[model samples]
Target: MKIKMKKFGVLLFAFLGLVSCSDDDDANVDPPFEGQSKSYDLTEVGESGVSGTATFDENEDGSVTITLDLDGTSEGVMHPAHIHFNSAAEGGEIALSLEPVDGDTGISETTVEMLDDKETEISFEDLMDFDGYINVHASADDLETLVAQTDIGGNALTGESVSYDLAEVDVEGVSGTATFYERENGETLVELDLEGTTEGNSHPAHIHMGSVEDAPGDIAITLTSVDGASGMSFTNVAMTDGTDDEEGTAVSYEDLIAYDGYINVHASADNLATLAAQGNIGANATEE
Candidate 1:
């Protein structure tokens, strides 16, 4: 009886030891991660018809995982992609390279802990404030042809915008709208969309110093020439064109919304006197 009782006590001690070890192990284990994510729309470039969403996922380990899921991608073609260091309208050099998207699946995933230089550490938070844009090329050979693109981070549009009507001046039926879009970085994107522009002609557009009610003034800023074929022009405005006393002076979206200026679209570069469209913007804009 004494030996049996001693064995039973030894068994109880082992059981308690096992329970203590289990509790210690549970205490040392790390908890599951709860992180955040952001998604940006990737618009189709030109007529490529490929568009999708780019998602940046924050990992518990402080890395960023970028996933691109696209539609309308051609099978058997590997598309190259990169993060460029500026607004899409104002193109800049590549800041980071991503994995080539598999055309068959129309998907790509990359875990980025640092920039392309491999020295600049980029966390998920850093990417949210990055001044960059993403471009997915058609293929390795056709780098100039973009399949999908989006302005991310600071260059993304803030959804605050103002538009002014560009009425026909010298040309009949040549008129459109000039829109100023606010960027997240406080810059502005000036877009000119016109109608009835002659095909194969490029129209010079500019922001003059004064309103149209006043006499024509000197150019305050130069804008991208309107493409007659597409009847579109996109210019990223960060500063004055340095044409006046405030040459290369810094400008913001806030400044332009209250600016005393007018926009003019000429018939062509050579015929500045022949206006295709004209419009008063900012403080001079009519309530209508």
Candidate 2:
């Protein structure tokens, strides 16, 4: 009977040792997310030459550092930068204020532990879960004017797309699709695919300043001319004033949320007065 009891005690001790070992292994397992870092492409907005990238890195201490780098800014100008509470498309409120970027050098380094509202203390992991974006204003005095920006973290458009169906205008049997690809470079690439048009003639396309409801405005961005033979035009565009002299306008994808903009395709390079096709763009524009 003593031998039997001793054997049972030994078995029990072995089982307990196994359980302890399992618990230790579980404790050593790393978390699903220990750290995170993301880079956002900032596009030109309005007339400001501001454009760059915002990189957010999570530190071991749980704080976040935002590094802003840009180009095409005027020397001696100060641009106000911020981290807003939502995606650029949604136009969110300011959640955190970053160090203002120098327009001349186009750089800003900001460390954040709390929000601009000051009611909330935000950590790097918190920012990863938060829906937010970065915005660079034209100047400190012109806070309302956004010159460059991009969505951050999960707010970014990954593998997403937007399109507009163009209609025949002035010229019958001429139409196309205006598709915008949200690229990682912080610039939207627009592809114009047209049909019912002649070959060997280049068609000038522009994103105008108005919608169909208000009649198309002047050229906002001059897109790459469509190939007469292929009926396709591809342009990696920064919003502009539709001039060769100017590039990368302050208009961005976020501005398209309520933008009164439209796409206009001219009949031919020489026939700039004639429209081959036209379509409203952005949230206010006709969507397919």
Candidate 3:
């Protein structure tokens, strides 16, 4: 299921002109946190999917500034993307959508004012304390229609993690419920679980880029299903540096399979490991 991000006020009028300006002027003030936009081709990372660019900047409050470039895709394209709440080795959710780009590249741009000072001020409610990374998703042409994914920008909260649950069962003629949620001490923790509903069976059952999709680069590691485990289980996988796999043995929340993750158990009735229903584990999941 896709969740639409509420459109707010448009205040980035001089973004382009300010790209070259310095956030600080006293020469030694070191300037407030500042960042730049980075361009990349999804194909370079075994994504062979498409092209896009993401811009990152330091907000006046210490958080981050983000701009997305659809590289030429259109809005109504129905791709999913988001900012995972935590930065753990486990996984997360799509906090928002990647507004499609305009012109030939389908490049779209937008900015966010962040506040990296407090944690209780999470969510985009206050523009002063939500310190999290910005991730993008690629629209996959799958039956589940999960946007195959990839992280385009921002730093995933390394200290934050998530809770994974086989929240739902009854898909592709299968019935089982296995879920587990555990977070490492001092690690990022973003809560994500499948809601019980006709959301559809045979989704790429694995860790996606905080969003639903089968694109590229965003498949943070794949989850493995033990022989006949029913129900869910939780693991306090540790994540260091908000990247994919840096903690003891747990997978880094930022490690996309492209870096050494896996997705298995397809959704097909035949091999039962078709592209869909496949449990793709992003990076590595360290044991608690």
Candidate 4:
């Protein structure tokens, strides 16, 4: 019960950071979370570690760190592990990576800075917005483990009641992340972050159905542009069905949540169908 309570408190803190509390002063207010850094010892859930740390700093620059103590049970080799988006129930692709430890027992760390450019250049604000979590994948196989799960929380200087991060596409010749943080008054807004995008022809992007941790039922969302390796991106994706719409092209909101899907940015210059930086769209309503 205590562990559950503590985890709940963290989730609440994330909620608070996203939006302000209700106006009723007399209303019962949950105790303010005392920001602190804590460590978690992961276990062998499937083929990787099952634990890490979710640090909530009182200072605005604090970020949540996920450390994986991997088992080097495999013969001499550097196993691949990444922090992916989605639930363990429905698997998704890799979003970030933990410092890999080779051999038998190794420790990989993924410290997601709340307000800095660290591991994946992702912000705590953005991560918290998706009800996000950490996923550690098997080195050689497709099997994976949902290591950490929680929402973003905190009180920053922004005075805004929104939880999410939006950055520009900056990949010059490799992988990158393209996302839309929120929709303001109906005009859809998104950002294309290319930090390692390969230079070549544009590739197709999609907002497939379902959450990261669940199986996708269908492709519900589509993008209106393709990305280049020069950190260039475009938007204005049609989210609804239309007449003369290309087959398997456009989708809708109902289709968005029906199946577990996410924002898939495909790589064109290199691997034909390979993904670059993929993440979930939006989380749940956190405001009270």
Candidate 5:
């Protein structure tokens, strides 16, 4: 009976030692991280049919993980991507290089804590206010061809926009609409979508100082030329054209919405007298 009791005492001591070790191990293990994430949609560029979402995940260590998931990529081909410094409408330099997306899986993941220069540290918080855009290229050989792109951070669209009709003036059937989209940074993106334009010609567009009913007015703002092939034009409006005496006047989305102006799409740069489309905007816009 004495021997049996001693053996039982030894077993109990071993069991207690095991429990203590288990507790120690549990204390040493790190806890799961709880962080936030942001996602931005990348739209298809030039009928590439490749579109995706760029997701930025904030890590507990103050780093960021960027993931790109695209659709319609060709199998076995890799696509290069990067973050550019300005709005997509206003092209800019590459700010950060990203991982190449695998065409077969159409996915890419990269962990970054710094810009391409390595000296500029960009945290997840900094990305929230970044004035930049993303571009995914077709490949290393064709970097100029963008498969997918988007305006992120401060350059993103605010979902508030105004559109004005562009009636045919000189041309019988050439007409379209001009839309002004508000940006998060208070700027505006002017997009012109037209139909019945000549296939190979380029049309000059502008916003004049007065209404179309008041005859012609001085050009208040110069916009991007409309491409006849695609019948689309994208312009970033930040200021008015600068003259010899003074600098360009600063313009914002708010100022544009209440300004007195008119839009004209000319047939060509040489033929300024001929109008492809004309419309009254701002205060002169007719309620319909």
Candidate 6:
């Protein structure tokens, strides 16, 4: 009976020690927080054809991790990504630098204990108060050009889809369709699809001030030139009255609906004087 009692006590002590270690492990584990994540859907900027999502995660180690999953970039190209101060519409300055995004996978993962120019660690709660945005540049060499971006905590775009039909001007059998998509970021993406165009030629296209009545009054916004082989052009509208000095125009989508305009597709870049095709757009536009 004594031998049996001593064996039973030893077993009980081992069990208690195991339980104490288990409790210690449990105490070190971090609790899950339901509202510790923030997600933002990014969009294309400056005709870069890039779009993606940025997710910010608050880790248990007091560090914030940001993951960016993107698309519409060439493989093997590296892009510079950063957190900027203020909204995208306001063209904010970079506040925090992040790891360069890889083009092959289009993924950027970065962690932050604080901003690049700051010293103190920033909490997840305090980061929510950050009046900032994220902007992905074309590359390390071209930081001024933005490819994909989004406002962190700002108003989104809710607008309409508008399209127009083009007719042959001086060039026969040259025509196209121009579609304007109002993006969630309040920018307009104009895509031109043309047919019966010369295979080796490039067509310069633009949004003009007038319609059939005016016959290309003035160039309002320059568009991406259409490739002859694909007969397609995709550009973000910058209604700046076709000036070399103007950065961007003040024209909004609301103003576009009430403005009179048209589209002009030229035969070549050097031959802007000759129009291959033209279309009435905006207030005078005809929908099909």
lDDT of 4 at 157: 13
Q: Which runs of model 2 end up more than 4 angstroms from their true locations?
A: 1-35, 162-164, 169-288
List clash counts for every candidate, in order: 2, 4, 72, 35, 0, 0
Minimum summed lDDT over a 10-residue window in model 5 is located at 278-287
Candidate 4 at residue 214, lDDT? 70
Q: Write the per-residue lDDT of candidate 5 for residues 1-288, one digit (tens) a residue.
A: 999999999999999999999999999999898888999999999999999899999998899999999999999899999999989988999999999999999999999999998899998889888999999999999998999999988888999999999999998899989899999889999999999987889999999998999968898899999999999999999998888998889999988888799999999999988999999888888879
Q: Which tens-of-lDDT digit does each residue in 1-288 have in candidate 2?
A: 999999999999999999999999999998765667877789987566668899888877878999899988878988889888756654678889999888778899998888987778898767766777888987877888988987776556556568888899898888988888664445566779999877878899888787877764776777888877778887655466645565555655556545678888998889988998888888666433
Query: In model 4, which runs have C-alpha deviations exceeding 4 angstroms?
Result: 1-175, 181-185, 215-217, 241-261, 269-272, 284-288
TM-score for each predicted model, relative to the true structure = 0.87, 0.50, 0.32, 0.31, 0.87, 0.55
Candidate 5 clashing pairs? none
Winner on lDDT (1 vs 2): 1
**Of 3 and 5, the candidate ranking higher by TM-score:** 5
List the global CA lDDT of all models: 0.94, 0.79, 0.36, 0.45, 0.93, 0.79
Residue-level lDDT tens digits of model 6 in 125-207: 66666666788989889887889987663323344777788888888888988877665445566779899887889999888
- Tens digit per residue, CA lDDT, model 3, 110-140: 4544222323332223322332334444444
Candidate 1 segments exceeding 4 Å error: 1-32, 243-247
